[model samples]
Target chain A: MSGSPGAGRSRIVTWAVVGLCLGLAGALAWAMLDLPAPSTRLPGQVAAQLERSGVEHPVTAVLLNFRGYDTLLEIAVLLLALLGMLAAGVAPRASAPLGASSMLAALARALAPLMVLVAGYLLWAGAFRPGGAFQAGAVLAAAGVLLRLAGFLPAWTRPGAALRMALAAGFALFLAIAALGLTEGALLRYPEPSAGALILAIESGLTFSLGLILAGLFLAGPELPRREDGGGTP
Target chain B: MSLGLFYALLGGGLFALGLAGLILRPHLLAKIIGFNVMGSGAFLVLVGLGSRDGVADPVPQAMVLTGIVVAVAATALALALARRLLELSGDMVLPGERLRPGEDDDADA
Candidate 1:
């Protein structure tokens, strides 16, 4: 291993280190010295217009009305992620080996419910406040991860029709709303006075589907066999 | 572009770097690390942009809050995949070959 030893190896190592440092310096310099202007006038401009028109929950309005199409796509992206996980032959982690360290078990007991509560709060806050369905779903999934890690939850739960319903709710509900647009010429539009409520409703559905889909993806495959095996019993 | 512009560009660059690292690194776990870097970078950019008038953009910050969750979900999924790969392969880590199940025990002994 020491045949060519000091010279060749040291020279290469020295250059590699130098190159990395130089790259870092250059990147940092650029980021620090030059920054861009905000092209973020769209939201503000829209909000102002909504405000002028006395629109309630302008942020919600923006999300549900002007940007409903994007929201629809975002939800679709999440579905695709779950579907991709399936196609890739990945599955949710087997339920935690259960009864691991007492510390983990105790932590799960205390944190799981608390995390769920926080997720609910975050979701509720999304309307006329801050935060939303995505954050809530993440929190819910995190809680699930904790329980799974602590072995409190089985690697796979028995599949039920409820799971299927929850999984499809977001997409299905959004479709119904968009259908309204078709019938009323709104084209996925939310009318005033109901925009906030609609956004909240859509978000709730999104939270449920998103949480399940993510947890499913993170759960890893064998735990929930492919459709051919009939899900849950594992 | 101002700092807001700087924020987006820098964040985008970091994300791109992270994405590149995730793809280029052969190790399964390294991809996760790259993702974390990219996620953090993007988050920083969003937050940076939010601080427009020396106060954060409530909207971007909130959206980023949502984004953190999405990122976490993706990470969880990737991790589960890595763990399964290890279990199926009987290798604690085929990624970077960095950590093996009993390597630590051997070192301690």
Candidate 2:
């Protein structure tokens, strides 16, 4: 490749950008230098309020109960991104073998099931501990990506009606719940006795949708072919 | 002086580094990675700010968690676009520098 006329100008622009970035960074650091450690106002009250949300994990309660609106919008945003990818008209990569070693395939086979277990565990533990729907969904999606990379395209890579439904399930369920909550005088306000069940249900839907959405994104190169197996496991 | 402050400063640095990468790099993929770095920096800052009270704030933590999911979604979209651009143009660099109209040759490899 030969150097172009713009190369010199681009170099100068790059240096100027670098200087600007450095200055911005320094200014930000200096501005925050005097802030007190551990903000004076903690989320103690918010944490205490979690008991009323019918979940043991404060963060989970906050995400699914107190601030369900944000979660709802977030799921929507994820779906929107997936739609953008699909609209790009890129075909999924060919089904040709990924040139992976048999050992890698064997490893994927062993880990795939284990990943499911861990994801399930995380989803369950989210009600009481540090795990939640997003973490679980990500793990499940990682498993799918691993399988895809290892030349094990699940029979459902195509953006068929069923796959699309799964992708939309989380956002749809969340929106439904929010609408229902509106009838209860507050949007996303779950009844106390059923808050736990509702949150769990919503989380389950989210987990599935998020996993499928991620897998679809990973299969970005080609529009995945319709599975001949009619949704059966490969 | 607190650990949180240190992390916040680190977040600022990361943001700046990401900004520089985004601007200085001509490759679309590199810019995407830089965008992600910037996002993570913002997340770190949010997390640090939430920890201002000796106890971690669950609200901001939840926000950050949502942010992470959103960031990944955005990254995936960016990647898909980058891949598409590569497929169409036979190159992955941003258009302004490498793809001036009427320049048919790959001037700079």
Candidate 3:
């Protein structure tokens, strides 16, 4: 198939890349095989201090309490990514009007409220089981996406002051709490008595802000017009 | 080998595959997908290694959860950039990269 010089060179490059990947895989396998046992076990440590960490679920405890600094920075990173997207300077195209799909609209109407309820459950369940702000926020975002698809909500071009505030609320609250913790001798060190309540409050704010941010990631982008619709310039 | 080791090895394979895809693919969207594949492989490695001793470790699991949310955010930003490029240049491939003859036609299509 390499009939031309360019094709031959491309073939060679492909082979080299494949060879490099194989070597990487081999090296990784070798490293794993020769790995020494870790000196400290984190899971045990988490379990030992679970009582003081606030949440019953170990993962939740680690995320919202033990390593909360990471979560705080993560929320900041999410907001930054959204900000970058907004600053990319792509003009918002008009959203396509929904066709007569009453079934889809009805389905979205039925599911939206249910999804909101599920998100709430997930938020409440995070204290004891394998559910948390992230899952809850994701569900809420999915609902928003569905609503947009069903024509109940329109694509966002520019967010208003309230919307912007809503988007930043979670990160701001997290930072504030972390700052307040400085008075407690350490960053994010919640008072033991109110740790659960504090974590819950944080999760609730995160769920609200994260939901908007995640949905905005999709809805903020301009929708491409269909070619057959005569929307493109010749 | 233990289950954890097996998963770790699988993750290594996935990482290698994703690396190849990221390097070899010409389309920006494909490159983004390749990047996601690489991220997933790394997440698998992290959790697998942490639990190789048979105990479920919450630290790596929590980190992976955090990584997932960040990955979604990154993917969204990347997609927005790609769409902007498509709007401005009418193609998804970056400039200066030579497209195979048939690939150019595909891009126009």
TM-score of chain A of each: 0.70, 0.84, 0.91
| Model 3 regions more than 4 Å off | A92-97, A223-234, B104-109
Report the C-alpha lDDT of model 3 over A53-123, residue by residue, as the tens digit. 88899999999999998999999999999998988857755445443266767788789999999999999
Among these predicted structures, which one has the highest TM-score? 3
Instruction: List, residue by residue over B42-91, the lDDT tens digit for candidate 1.
Output: 78777776664464454665455556655765776577666767668855
Q: After superposition, which runs of candidate 1 have C-alpha atoms over 4 Å from their true positions?
A: A1-36, A49-63, A87-96, A100-115, A157-161, A184-186, A221-234, B1-26, B62-66, B80-109
Judged by whole-model lDDT over C-alpha atoms, candidate 1 comes out at: 0.64
Better TM-score candidate (1, 2): 2
Model 2 ranges off by over 4 Å: A1-11, A36-42, A91-96, A154-158, A223-233, B99-109
What TM-score did chain B of candidate 3 earn?
Answer: 0.90
Predicted chain A of model 2: TM-score relative to the true chain A?
0.84
Candidate 1 C-alpha lDDT tens digits along A82-131? 65555556434553323446676677788988998998898888665656
Q: lDDT per model, in order?
A: 0.64, 0.81, 0.87
lDDT of 2 by residue, B1-109 (tens): 6676677788999999998888766678778989999988988888876764456779889999999999999998988788888778879887765644433433235
State the DockQ of every prediction.
0.22, 0.62, 0.76
Residue A225 CA displacement from its true place in model 1, Å: 16
